[model samples]
Target: MITRTVVMRAVRTVVFTLALPCLLVAVWWVASDSSTSVYAPPLRTILSRFDDVWTADRIRGDVVPSLLRLAAGYASAAVAGVVLGVGIGLSRTARAVCEPALEFLRAVPPPVLVPVIMLFAGIGDTMKIAVIASGCVWPVLLNTVAGVRAVDPVATETARAYGVRGAAWLRSLVLPSASPQIFTGLRQALSIGVILMVISEMFAASNGLGYAVVQFQRGFAIPEMWTGILVLGLLGVVLALLFTLVERRALAWYHRSRGARRKAGSGGA
Candidate 1:
């Protein structure tokens, strides 16, 4: 069964993990054959560049800072999104005051804000993190609101009957119900985070996979450029799979308890 799951996962994984580069290679080979002399570097050349890209100097100088920026941005978005979502879901007054403004804010494209954000934040990690956070926070915030609001009122009443009322009541009754949606949001946000990280790096940074790619492209080092892009794409796939695993583990109890309840209900009926 685990093998089956792994195999199924391979299909999705390979598209990101393998197929893209394979496709790039096929494109390169074809284009190289055509006479795009300067533009087309074939598969072997790009493949060879991966070693240099992975060198300790490259890793330390570029990859560490990129990962740090992503972590800070993603973590900030997750925390703020979850907190504000919970607040919106739990309190009508707060929701009324905050939700519309948030919706408006979310509607504005993240890249558009980069120029404005950079004015205050400058072209550094701060601006990158802020841009990433802004881009990712919306999906998580909305998903969390949906999750909490969708919890059954009957369940809340049951909790109340057992004296589970107020904030404590919510912690016992609503949050568990909302956990799945929260995780779903986190997964979606993580993907968005990766995209934004790359975009931010491309626009303003001195280091990162995007920076490496841009630098190589400018210098006409086509293979190195491709290598940087490939590494970034791989990083995205790895992070997505890791988040999915975390989601499955976090919601395992919820799924089991739900299945058991449904089975018991069916027997009684």
Candidate 2:
């Protein structure tokens, strides 16, 4: 099963994955060695401090809470978005009634809502979660609606003709057709979720990665701040990789279908 093409592709992927990061780190290591800048501490200094600052004790206080808030907010958004999107996509009346409100709310930048949320939710973890959820919902909701609405008319008609109805119809036809777009929305929402998590924490919080980063910066602990930044960047990468794996698993059928189509088109040509 391991063909030359597959082997080559794997090699390419590994190289592509490691190349940029290795190059960047090497460059930083070189460039920062001679730097006397107070803010831009040497990469070696950052790495040394990174080890100390991101230890288990610090992670328990900072990283865990941030990750938990992110998960809660993202999960809440995903559920609400998919449900509301389905409702809106299925019913013209619902779309007509809800679209304007959705548009209005989506227009308001997520960060602006942090203060409002804090005022009501009182600067607690709840407020941060709410702020993040508010931001994350829009992409999933809008994409789901678009995807559902864009389902092939012929497919819908065929299902109707076959006496398919209600939940069965949705399960059999709508969801499969709309899944790719829904996944796209989820991907967008994931990044937005991270951004909102940081914003909410930075805006108001006694604990969190963002809070710790700001505290470090305020105290002029530049290397510690860099470690926070580095940790966040690494977290984003890990989250993205995790999402990609989940997406591939969830949309395996979709990928197979696309591959089949490509083969068909190639053979026809």
Candidate 3:
């Protein structure tokens, strides 16, 4: 059963969440209604053309391939980053040995590496996925290391004292402590992956959303181009929302613990 307060809060959230977007759409509609710019099409025209351009064929050819590359790259980065991050975080020697190389690689922007990747992997899906993975890996790696290192020393000592040894100890204690930071990295990586996916397709792709947008712009299909841009924005928002839901579910315990701590502090005060 929902209380009045809960209902009110839900209503308020819905209003605040939707208010800005609706306002912006209203403004855009009003502002562009009478405009005659070739580059900036009217909002209504763009909306109408969205269905024509982003049809089933386009979705199968462009959107599906783009999503596949993003998923493959992001998953690979998450696994590799966590593994390497764990090693570096847990071992001072590993951290010292790898820090310089990792720093150098991370400093090189992923977009710049597209040419170099193409030289080796050619202009295939593999190259695109590699570029996305390269861009996404650093955030997760750095965040995981930071999270692991930030785990309470006292907790580690206590675990050691209690004979919580080996992989069991790491799985039970270390991973949970570091999960928050790891998730932070994953979130950062997700955005990077999306950016790289587009950039990769822009550089040397025959298909994908980015390629379509580029093609549309080159062909002077202003409304279609705008539609592509709008779709990309919507995709980012949708992916972010999905990730947030997953994060909340995965970190429910951490959230509850923090809430409990806050309540205790307030009570004491």
TM-score of each model, paired residue for residue: 0.83, 0.96, 0.97
lDDT by residue (1-269, candidate 3, tens digit) is: 98999999999999999999999999999999998999887899999998899999999999999999999999999999999998899999998999999999999999999999999999999999999999999999999999889989999999999999899888989899999999999999999998999999998689999999999999999899999999998999999999999999999999999999999999999
How much is the lDDT of residue 192 in candidate 2? 97
Task: Show pairs that collide, candidate 3.
Answer: none
Give the alpha carbon lDDT tens digit for every residue of 1-269 in model 2: 79999999999999999999999999999999988999998999999987778889899999999999999999999999998898899999999998889889999999988878888999899999999899999999999999999999999999999999899999999988998999999999999999899888997689999999999999999999999999999999999999999999999998999999999999999
Ranking by TM-score: 3, 2, 1
Best by TM-score: 3
Model 2 is weakest, by summed lDDT over 10 consecutive residues, at: 46-55
Off by over 4 Å in 3: none
Give the total clashing residue pairs for model 3. 0
TM-score of 1: 0.83
RMSD to truth, every model:
4.2, 1.3, 1.2
**Is candidate 1 or 2 superior in TM-score?**
2
Q: Least accurate stretch of 10 residues (summed lDDT) in model 1? A: 32-41
Error of 2 at 194 (Å): 0.6
Residue 261 error for model 2, in Å? 1.5
Q: Which sections of candidate 1 miss by over 4 Å?
A: 1-37, 257-269
* Candidate 3 RMSD to the correct structure: 1.2
Report, for every candidate in turn, its global Cα lDDT versus the true structure: 0.84, 0.94, 0.95
